[model samples]
Target chain A: MSQNVEPFKGLKKLNRKLAKLHHILKRDINISTVSTPTNNLVLCNSGLVNGLTEDQVFEHFSKHGEISNITMLPGKSCCFVSFSKKDSATSAYECFNGKLNISQNNRPVYLSFVEEVPKPSIEVIWNELPPGLLVFKNFISTEEELNLLKLIDFNHEQCGLLKHRLVKHFGFEFRYDINNVDKNQPLDQSVPTETDFLWLKLAQIQPEFKGFKPDQLTVNHYAPGQGIPHHIDTHSAFEDPIICLSLGSSIVMEFKKDGTHTCVLLPQRSLLVMSGESRYDWTHGIVPRKFDIIKTKLGGYTCLKRTTRVSFTFRKVLSTGKCECFYRSKCDSFLNCNIEEKMAVQLEKMHVHKVYDNIANHFSNTRHKPWPNVMDFVQSFDSGDFLVDVGCGNGKYLSNNTHTFEIGCDRSANLIEICRNRKFEAFLTDCLSIPIRDNCIDGVISIAVIHHLANESRRLQAIQEIVRILKKGGKALIYVWAHEQVKNKQKSSYIMQDRKNRKGTKEMNGQCLTSAQQVSLDSGNITLPVHSNRSNFQADDLLVPWKLKGDEEENESVFLRFYHVFKEHELEELCLKVENVRILKSYYDQGNWCVLFQKM
Target chain B: MKLLTHNVLTSKCIRGVTVGYPLLIKATNVKVSEVEFKPDFVAKVLPKIEWDVLANAAESLGHWQNLPKELPNNYENDTDFLKKIHRVLLEVEVIQGELICPESGRKFPITNGIANMLLNEDEV
Candidate 1:
């Protein structure tokens, strides 16, 4: 009869068996204990705490009200601590162990817990009592979700001291969305996919984060001398306990406790669960500096090497309307108006320096020699000005410096060493994690660095770092490869690669330029092979037509296309989103876009 | 010659104008303020301007009287010139009058020291 059963019937039978299994578990627990209390309810099996004293453990249980009964069995290993209300039990677990570590069996053992969750209302409870705080950790998918987030732009557009809020008596600064905050589903903004599975586990442990969904995520990318200033989140937009997930690098997430500073180092991949008195009552910020070294004097871990880091700052935005206005007014297109508005406002308010502006005006005086213009630009900087040349390449700008005190940092140590060889000090550094002091520099200048970063998070972080160093009314200058400049490079990559193989064009002036001989793909899409110049293009033949893909275009008789051009309006809008860094000038010429800005 | 002004006074934007956006100013009146020199502030103003346009404007305003014809070998002694340049670029108020586009001959008036260059509804 079982063999003759249809697929539907077979499925039904499986469901029945599952139901019977649950009943058996319930019956076994019931038979073991006598006179179960009226308030008792069983937690799930197989997923229970392993070991603890009855007194110590009971304290945790009683705090959530009272543990009516406890059933423990060896081999069965799992013990049931019955609670008065299912919701109360769930909330208690979530509030206390949000950042707790779980074992291979999905059971928590380390007691990484938070206490005294701030209660805003009397309705929420552990059994009949609602805790004042909520806690959670590792809600992100390590392999899939994190990798995906890196590819996408996670910059908070709005980052600046709120002039509007200052008028209201609170010293508040915000990094909000440039696009509308309310347009997308909250879960979509915070957790892009449900398959993360880890979040489900966290939700099971802490039910507080279950109802509150995050609609946006801000990735704070900092390097030395780069940090967000002391600021309060918009109370009208989001409620307390901003959940911050630190990754890649470490930083001091400082909180102003009373008149003293209570700082905590947000270690890599760690979650900082904060709210109530810690959230609404205090200000938080990262102090700009190079490597976060926890020395004996500092009383923490040793010096942690600075790396390209990205932090997912998640918070539930309460006011949807405020977010929408800030985003739509900033983005180029009003499409996705809801999400775009919040993003725009956030980005504009965020700390973004205009490195192009200072560079552009470095030669603004027509009558003066270019040297004088450079000098004026240089002298315009302060004695202790902290300047960074993002793609300092060979530190050409630093080599030409009249000022001696500024720091010159680059991603390539070889290039920095060359600067050092030239008696111009430079260091090996990445734009994503600039090593400098917060609000310490008077000016920053970056030339052709934004394009070098492979993704948006790196680009935004680099910009933020520059902003972090400059004092109020400080200056920033940025020179970008106008979409045209990058396109030209793309074209040249192909021609140089093709010529190097000696299968395409003749060498000219001791250099070769030809189409690519290979094709490459990234995430299923065809990508133009990057010409490292060492392997593909030579020093002599710097200008050549190149395709994004390796050899596919040459074989298909397709002309390699350059893909980084920005229309004037789009560039203008991009500049406007940088808060405090007001757009002063945008120039389009010579296959590049130059922009200037100042901190307000 | 603020970058903000330079951006709005482009040659093509002037209806009835031809070219040479970023006007080449021939200043009849000039003023310099002795404001506290803020290097960061000056650095912030750098990007919004066209170097060549500002150079020409500085020359026309006589602010380049002390500056070099090109970038100097060393810029240390150029503080006075820089301050003058800063005053010209950021502080000098041009409260009354108009900026005539050199190419288009279209007048973009400076009323209350702010240029009014709003295009006709159809010209956006």
Candidate 2:
């Protein structure tokens, strides 16, 4: 099959429209363009440019030689540059919304370099590159310093290399001890030594990581044929770049690039920063293999033997003190109660993952803007109805006026301001403490907010808040994540650590640290949730975190055992339990379990 | 109204518990109305529907039994199968009775043909 046939259609159409749009937009507005008559600089002819649509422009760009990188701004034009050689770095000199301008038909095309563009300057410190972008020389020392030749069980010895990568990329250090290594063990059982934590501390020393920290560092040990499946890192609790440091073995980190395979070998001691495409766009996994002859060994040595490999994947979570949504009771009726067994199980999984993924997707997508669902919802409501939006991330729904009188509350202030600026009444409040008086609002809506909150007390508190704010007979449209919604054939849920005597479920082990614990911890090269309003929970547990207090029991946090799945019977039961709350309608919204209730 | 819901609905959760839950309808029991096709809506619902369960339910009901075993990307015309699907999933309303759970085997009967799922504490 021709690669261009099905895949590039959208891009093709986009290019054509863009070309036409550029011409029209140029005529419609005065843009500052700089022109120099150079034969090497190929500018489209006026008539051709005028008549050209977006598709033609794309075709033109496609035909105009090999395009290395193409990016479109939020404006009418897009900029792409072609390199003369493979590794030759050529800057566009601040094109589009920058100082760089192009003269077309005796008119300068307007581009702004005043804002949102990197300032052009010669290098002082090569480290001066932006936080996400940096290059360091001598990142790793020679093999003698590495002392690899003198070690047994090369996997444990290789922790030094992994530490080297962490310091180079994430500005962290690690430590490992041979005694801690469980040699000749299963993939998940092998443990990282003190060097791992030492590298973590090195990463912490970086000024950029200040205040942002890591609570969990999942050490995944891989042998041949052992691999992780297609899945997202559970960052709903934290917004950070998952830093992965590879050691001992060479494995291909298979990344999905626009649905195509883009395999990159993670060589020994090589630090691969996975974010953006690697994080959001593609899933990463290593195919189980004993021998990887593809990668060259460190210090001109021949290929090394594969014993076992360890990866230290670290992240920082932005805590939401109280989970906005949660299932109050497990559907225990399944064993004893009567229901469609298959349907019940399927539905239960659907609800669990549905809520989980939806909430995650919503936050992931809207982290930079307002929630997109608010726009669709506001169009249905009238102005007079007092609307209460629960878990309103930065008030995207409230900002746009469908109804004039609306109260949007969220845990994150950064998100609230985004909504508040849009014209909706936004507040930084928890779902439980709903700032509004009881029986005040006409309608209440919570979308994709409940699943992140896996605590029962918090979920109950939020429901009560929603009930208290709404007027008698007011409508409540609440959406929950369904189970098994996240499907990537490659997911592997290996036990991280099994602490048998732990108070909580086996799933959490003893790793259940409060978001507050995340503070003052070392995050390996991961971004913090500064822009998110949900990170407030990282600071406190009783007030913003909304958990129980004052007793030894308060010190213990609940670890998720079984997924808090909802059965049809359980849903009906819940509807009955919430006094004066009647079920209005229930349906699936984009693979989620949505229930419409009314305060009667 | 969809046959997919029908396959899952049984008179088993509670006495009248299945009432509104499965909210029953007679074979020749309800009204079928025609609405303009919305491809977007159909696409949205496609992933949510259980194909096997829907097909079995359609076959048992004897409506649109000729539907292709797999879900087609696009349907050109409103075939008997399509109509049946549309009718059962969207239009047919249970004017009365409870929907029972196939696994739990409890009776949730419908009153006024409306299934009421409310149960006492002992049952909960």
Candidate 3:
């Protein structure tokens, strides 16, 4: 009786899962499940992405009758197999529905009769390999393959550094974490001397490898179940051509980019050279499976079980300082400003520079009032002394004192234009590089500027540039927005003057701003959270929305400006990093960390 | 962009450009305004100024009015020399021009007296 109940419970669970699968198929792919028998059968849990390769499904389904075609969606868990006769399809579906247990995953295969097979999103081009991907079969003799394999010396070399496969590196160790190498750290070992014979052989067969020489060689020993994750070789890390010589076995290496996926068969003793688009843009990886669906010479598909495969991947480390690959978005060298820096620049360009450019006229009108402390700093300079107000919006402080020759520079060209029209001396320049003579200016006032910088290093760099431009004994004043709006029970003007924005126009959830967008960091990935305009500071880096008011009350347009609001001691610590500067005064005034430093 | 700012500006920030200093000026619009002639300030700034760069920059803008090619020996007391240097360095400005990087030939444009020395993403 206990055994009978156990079977009933198991049947109930299977029935529930089958219902879920039915709903998913109907909702996602629009393949309606029909109770009546049809010529087509959709096998759930059996697909290229779902542990089952295409040949496995064909082999099982074709056993019932002749199969017209089998369609397996890439990166999906359902495969459609249609038979020439409806009886064959029904019989196969009857036999496999909740009965066939997949040997690979040990999961029960669910099958349901469907109206028709969903067409492949990408057209099938079996003969075509991705452009720039060249494979030369029989490039090396069997003897050369054995000799190169022997030189690897698993027992003598550092093998199995990674869990997925056994790999040995020569010249430089490829860092999987950063997807790049520390070019400075060269290994004592070099490419095996025995493989030099391939150069003479390549000259006879493939002229593409005629003049190529590689400094870095990674000998990868992949077992049947081992594979490398899909990735493009770091564009800045290596030169154009990446050559790999396969030995001992043949396997289908998957190539994918955007939405197109192609698998190329790298036969045993083949030399594969990936350059240009194939090398820099498309990602290539081997699917870790025992069997691969291979195309036969007769244009028919068959299963080729994977064997012990080994490859000698050769690459020349890019000695050139930078890579100017045409694939700008995909190139690592182009993204030389690591992801954080990229995000910073992107955030600034969209939120800061472009926003200020669009709202320059309104921004200048709202920014006429000069802080008393900054005014006093500008006036403190001696008559005829050269003073620069970095990021002087609208040049409010440019003509404050006629005794000294003051120049205003800002990142915004429109603001600079306004200053020019006012007959004041101003220039367009980013605070990161002042574009001014070093050690020439007697005084510098950078009020409410550094906070616009998106990151710590950039903000620090701006301050350092200020120090670089100031003459010895020259004083500079910097002010950044403070994290704490209310200190000592006294509310700052930023909070006191926030009466209009208190009622946010859009009812954003308190947690909405903290959307966890995964940011690829050198250390790995981190979720860089976005922040809303909240009273309490939860993050240092955030987008502060500024509503550009138009003529009408409802005509307000919002623009986000990136801000790195300073915490206590953050401003002082950054200034201390500049070796030549002495902090004259550091204080909090009106929700801002104001610092007066002199170049010593 | 004033000749004073041009004195220290360099395009070394661009990749592969080493000696981007002493940028050559090519001005379409040049303006010279009457600045308060302060001989003492000009004398102090003269030491920091790249004199050859200043002279060439003024010449390129077609505002080089009998200014000396080199800083005169002990010329701080010479009010005439100081006044000439002051006019070239501070008074004459490149309103609409380009500051061409000597090494890379990359141009930084000066529009409305503002020189945009910003490098593109690929350049950096």
Candidate 4:
């Protein structure tokens, strides 16, 4: 059976290669030369290399090998270099071919063997374009095109030179100093009165763009070998429906989106309106070439040679805040509400409970000493008062006030057992639904428990439960871990170290704290362990670690416990939800938010 | 589980049990170990406990004696009566038993002085 499987596996590999070859051939790209070896001549097919002289080509290629000759085709914006030896050509191809930042302009030079020079073919036709693209041929008469061109001074000395194209801004001075369109500063020259006629003509042609009174216009004069780089107009900088009117010569503009490509031909005196998906999602650019081969409906191709061309690009500056488009992927307003809910449940079951269970013994070991502030609150109750210590881990506060009947309760069975072993009155129950009667407890002390609730509503519910269990005028002391544990100066250093240590742990607990709260703790070696399964960590939740003493077989074990450290105001806000509870005092102690509230 | 803890316990958290207070005790095994008598603690907890429920639970466990059907006017100062209340509330522990919810008949087991009142997901 093994021998038979080997032959079948070989057949599968052969079938996959054949399928890939079929796809490449159907795309009409050069397949023969791409697969076969070639001579010692290499062709630079980049449009950027049109202005390079023979000396410039020799200077760069000579480093790889002894160049016999260099031929520069200025008309085609390409160059051919022949090396004296085959190895030198191979070395040059290996080092520089298809690599970016090899020339002065830092543009990638598309290098290929001279024999494998790919023939031009239309990548995509007009009908196959993505939605929100409309192109109209002969949108304006030849006389109207000539009249529009006459309004702009093509040979103006102040015209900006972008690569090989001549550009002039009408309403705003498009600054070349910055790569993006300048929106903060206004240009000295506003839109010319003559250009108003062209705007009116555009409105007459496309009624949808009638209300779009564009305040910015950029006229570009491109020579036969010049072209613009592929780019999507900044969504925040410009309004939709950018109009580009082509004049003097026809051209093919390529639109690319998420690995799919489409091309549309703009005939002379034609107007192309880009809005919606085409304006925001797809990138449009033109390849600088002397000729373009377009596919016709009859399954044939027609070659259109290039000449000097002029284009008018009109745009309206965005006059609003962030875009609120329904296409969230393309817009900036993409948020998932379902993921937030899932995270809350995961934080409880997976990180909080699982980690506490694993480190129950070790956690009890560290929690031996009760805080001084909590001890004071316990003693405040009368000698015979009945108090319940909610989330009373290891019964730390259970025996604090011997005179008062203090009952400890915790969700962890292991921790509850420890409480019972110490002879402290204890019970097992969830904080959301305690087994006790309402308005029965004289005092409730819930220390370091509320923060474990990952969701805001659940945190509020926990506080509400405490209020419900308290007797009228009964006081309850609640404590939650604070986000900012350490003071100001050491904050950044602590967070960096915390992140470094968190990477080594298997499970992450709560949300991540803000930068200010991420201060370094005095115990430098101690850092929280983050959960390994969860990805979203934008919140102030964290996983604290507990180190366990190991037996002879193992050294030491680290367990991660989930905690949602509270902001000072967060605990106060949660307490505000309980109807009858009046906040007596709220303060921060030992990096924990302590709130003392009483039932009315 | 002492009658004091059972006095505050309820099965209302269980499904199909709207009124779950005063759980019916069906004791298979019970122990009465004497705990320290705290007269003030017993007096303070008296108001919080449901009198009828405590009386019913104590009677079901066969531990009721000298417990009044109604509270005496001078109960706080009644030391003899307070000592009896303390014994029934804290000293009388169910070593091994079962507590049945009167409304839903859900049984919570008791073993080694600890009562397991946790419910299954479907039961809750």
Best by DockQ: 4
For residues A474-506, write the lDDT of model 1, one tens digit per residue. 777776554322222233332334354334221
Give the per-residue lDDT digits (tens) of candidate 4, residues A15-113. 454455435433533333242334444443433244554444554566676665554443544556666666777776666644533433554444555
Q: How many pairs of residues in model 3 come into backbone collision?
A: 1
How closely does chain A match the true chain A in each prediction, as TM-score?
0.30, 0.29, 0.56, 0.44
List the candidate numbers ranked by lDDT, top first: 3, 4, 1, 2
Task: Please give the distance, in angstroms, between residue A314's alpha carbon in candidate 3 and its true position after superposition.
Answer: 1.0
Which should have the higher TM-score, number 1 or number 3? 3
Give candidate 2 regions above 4 Å deviation. A1-207, A210-212, A293-305, A321-600, B1-124
Task: Estimate, for each residue in B67-102, the C-alpha lDDT of model 2 and write its tens digit.
Answer: 778887665354544555565555544434334454
**DockQ for each model:** 0.01, 0.01, 0.25, 0.38
Return the lDDT, model 3, position B87.
88
Candidate 3 interface RMSD value: 2.6
- Share of real contacts kept by model 1? 0.00
lDDT for position B72 in model 3: 77
Q: Which of the two candidates, 1 or 4, achieves a greater DockQ against the reference?
A: 4
Give me candidate 2's TM-score against the actual structure.
0.26
Q: After the best TM-score superposition of candidate 4, give how far the Cα of residue A465 lies from its true spot, in angstroms.
A: 2.0
Q: Model 4, stretches more than 4 Å misplaced?
A: A1-347, A483-568
Model 2 lDDT per residue over A292-370, tens place: 3222222111222455666656554434312122211211111212223343233323333233223443343445554
Please report how far candidate 3 places residue B80 from its true position, in Å.
41
